[model samples]
Target: MHNNEQLPNQPTGCGQFDPRFLAQIRRNLFSEIGANNAQGLSKNLRQQLEGLPRNVRKEVVEEIGDQCAALFYACESGNVETVDYLVKVCGASIEQRGISMCSMVHEEDWYFCTPLGGACAAERLPVVKYLLELGAAVNGSSECGSTPLHIACGVSRIDIVEYLVEHGANVRQRNHSGETCLMFAVLSESLCGYLISQGVDVKARDLYGRTALHYAIEGGNSQTVQLLLEHGADPFAETRYGNDPLQTACLTGALSIAHYFIIRYNYTAERLADTLELLGTTMIDTSNTQAVMYWRLANQLRWAVPRYIQKRPEILPRSAFENRVEFSTGADLDAIAVDEDAIRYQGLIILERILGIGHEHTIQVMTDVGYQYEHSVQRDSRKCMDMWLLALQMRVQKHSILHYKTCTTARSIVRLMENVLHRNVTQNDPNTLRFEDVFAMFQLLVSNILETRHLLSVQPISRVQQDNHDNTVRCLTHLIYLLLSTAGNQTERRLVESSVRDLLRHDIRCVRTNESLLHLSVSRLKMLESEYVVDKSGTVGIFPNVNVTNLLLECGADVDAFDRTKSTPLHTACLPLNHDREVVRALVEHGAHLDRPNLYGDSPASLLAGNLANDVVLGKHISLKCICANTVVGSGIPYQGIVHRMLEGFIRAHEPV
Candidate 1:
């Protein structure tokens, strides 16, 4: 009667072979290895095998060897008694390993080694203790060097981690990724204290020269980073790419860690030399050091500013850039000048980073921020490339085109456009994109064929970025929708739409409805295709797209939220003109309501019937979906709208009673 109780011939979750013969009939198994029955039932198979004639029994036993029948299922389910019975009574090898079919397909060997690894990963304390007592190799690694210790730390199994280390497991051994048990321990703050006490190397760097401190910083685990540092970790250790802990912290957006590092590394004269030393030059020259610091400040700010603009701009304190500089505030900054200082110190670069992320009040904010006088048009003309380009492109006035003549060359334009379109723009994705990204988005969406051809004339983006063009498409569509849906000035919309046909570029004369207001990027679903995560309970779920979806949602895109015509993004994704199914799957996976009706009172499933209008049987197949809106409104109300009546009835006949 239990939910996971196996039917007679089914293989349990822990990896048992269903006889190829029996696989044809009722072959479904438990979705995951369930709790093992403590009452030994290893002999249950004996009765089934004994019922066969002598020759048939011999053949079945030969086909499925005694070793194979030892089914690691008991260990996976943590059934100590069942494992004991299989080992003692059925002659199963105590150390017999099980090859995980899931691991094989995904190329991730979580349960790759002996059953003990699976037991440890499952945090089955009793099963693990039993296996270790039975002489299972404590240091055995799977193909990926994933050991019991690594698994324990990953799952935050502190008790099991302490037990394994106490029982001869090597605490300092690195995995195939060159990460140590301590590196994995970042996942468990509790594991860090124990591993360090057991004498694991607190300062061990990975192949990338990233110490546990770097991992901790990247993980936003300030507590763990502090723990590692207190245990003698080199907080000043730099990666091979020259990223010190603070710089790495900045890149990873761990502002708290960066702040902590700053307070510790700076805020005094004692570590000023040390801070400069970490920047990687043995220099006594104060001027050179200040310049380098300026550049480093710019480098860090360039990344930090854009990110802050997009998601956490409000968090950017007035003194955020103050800690990086040594001079008193408002002192002699003008003397240095834009071109005179590091590229990071350029007025245009600072302005673009702060206000260029498509905000309507960007220009006014510049004026209010009191930096406009500092960055006058004359200065921008001389130093800032982005401003120069914007001037050339947006200035429809008589002399705006003169920027190209006065400041830039023809070859420079092509080179700059190519670099902007291809590299910087792509790197700045919709998730974290600002001015450059918006520019590229507009270019791709609004530009005509000749313009697109011209942009790609240098080098085409061959399968750029994170695999497919889904993210780009999603970002552009979202941008277009945001612009069109907002009650902006008609002149602005007309100008923008006219400039880029992709915005609201459809023919008004056409009869068909265009779901421009809603966001349904078919490419969005393709994002979820390969993303996955292994939970604490050892269950794998396809939820890696959580970040992408979360970022969009946080940025104010709605799921059940509809466009002007009442179509939600989900309804838009399922349009017959755009039935990627993946888009629908992605939205549903991200918690979109499946049965929600659109403005026209039609569910997403009902919209799929549009493509099948000519096919009688398929139309009927989606019938129940067709009447969903009417059903919700009440049968007594009757279907009043004539527009949806034909499509609804054509499909409604197939609805289940």
Candidate 2:
């Protein structure tokens, strides 16, 4: 091990500290504090440590700072009594710092801090004063460089903020992110006013180059924005992303703040129109149906503005959708307000145009819009598929073929295709799911699988990479099932066959289950069953599709390959839940040996016999080669020495259960 490399399970230079004991102490502290028995708590804790050797006890006491310390817990719980006991008797350092383990309102909300910072975070002003009196550093920072004043202001603890500042906490201190107390205090109007009065810079930019006004706008607090602006916060101050207060308000869907900016800041009529359009588009990305509200507001504001300032263009630029909708001046903006479909697509188009087609945000909004279309009252599969196709094209270009985003989008499309095909078949509609789209999606999946295998050949793969490869494989299988379901014409059938052949030519196996595509198609694995039931489309038990089974075999899939359970495709097909006779017949026709046993010593023929209660005979006319192999195995011959090296394993596979 290199000197610089640390074991993940062990902290630096503290091998003697046992994390289990620390966890036990946490549990005991909570229970004991709840019982209000501070004396018993201290006594029991000391006894737990007394069992260890003196050196280990000292190490545990000192190393508590490296973990969640008792002092921080006491501070957070406002248990001043425990704070004194731990520091005075238990040898805990007064300045001990660690992750605060109290007041866990959220799982990920805990933070690393000293005792004073912990108290301030929990808003326990009494505990803050007690820690300060105990000589806790008033200006002590947490692991993130956040001082007590920073925490106090962030959570709007104005009283605590005043006390900390009076106790000599630096009001101008910047954290590791270059954020001052003023930046964190922007959410509180009184706190912001006080911090400004104390000489904190109101216009100070953080490491992200965002001013206090920008933070206030993003926080969606008008009063805080008002206070910061009155204190000289620049409304035109831009962040590193070039987003000012108005743009921040638009992005965050803060319509009231945007309105307030126009009322107080006197934004131009053109600027208000642009902001309203941006706001409407943002709402479309988030709220599918409520996006028209902003369009109506924009029209109302347009009419409210003075007639002289209404020098708008005859027609705004068309949105980037296929429909290319354009809004004319004045009353024409109301058209989009009434058309929900236009509102949905126009929002997606505006986002893609602003964020770039290949940006992750664009991809996400596109996928979200597609989901809304799919689940709408009419189940608009056409619009849904269109959005997903656009998203898939961008994802394939922007991300790796096996990236989770690309794989996820492709899987969603395949599942949608399944639902569409089932609906079409039930409704007797021949033109519901287009054959060209299925073929195109199938070709994309095959290309991704082949590319993933190529990458695997050139580089060692990680677990994440292997899982992604398996996911892509599953996507390909579901897609092929769709193709097989709708192979109505000779051209479509040929496309499906060619794609399956291209996919099966690679030596791909599901990395998690170690099952080949043939095994997966035949067995209907447990994970795949629940995954197939995406919605209440009522297309259950569609897997083990006989056409998909035969297609894989026709594409030259290995029929006798062993999965992780040492079961061949035949053994899997013979399982009770997956006893599809057609699948079994297909496998047998593909030269799957019926008498081959799995690792559990159960042959396909025997398992099938057990399942059928001798109702039908299978593999009755055994070949002479199989008879010889069975005779050697049944007679307990040492075939490993007598038979050819390749034939030895094959002969052993036929041994009796």
On lDDT, the leading prediction is 2
Candidate 2: clashing pairs of residues? none
Residue by residue across 248-314, what tens digits does model 2's lDDT show?
Answer: 7877788899878877777777677667767888777567445666666665776675653342333
Positional deviation of 543 in candidate 2, in angstroms?
Answer: 1.4
Worst lDDT window (10 residues) for model 2?
1-10
Give the count of colliding residue pairs in each prediction. Answer: 3, 0
TM-score of each: 0.39, 0.61
Report the C-alpha displacement of residue 166, candidate 2, in angstroms: 21
Tens digits of per-residue lDDT for model 1 on 216-293? 887788899888889999977977655678766654556578768888765433233223222321111224444445
lDDT of 1 at 315: 26
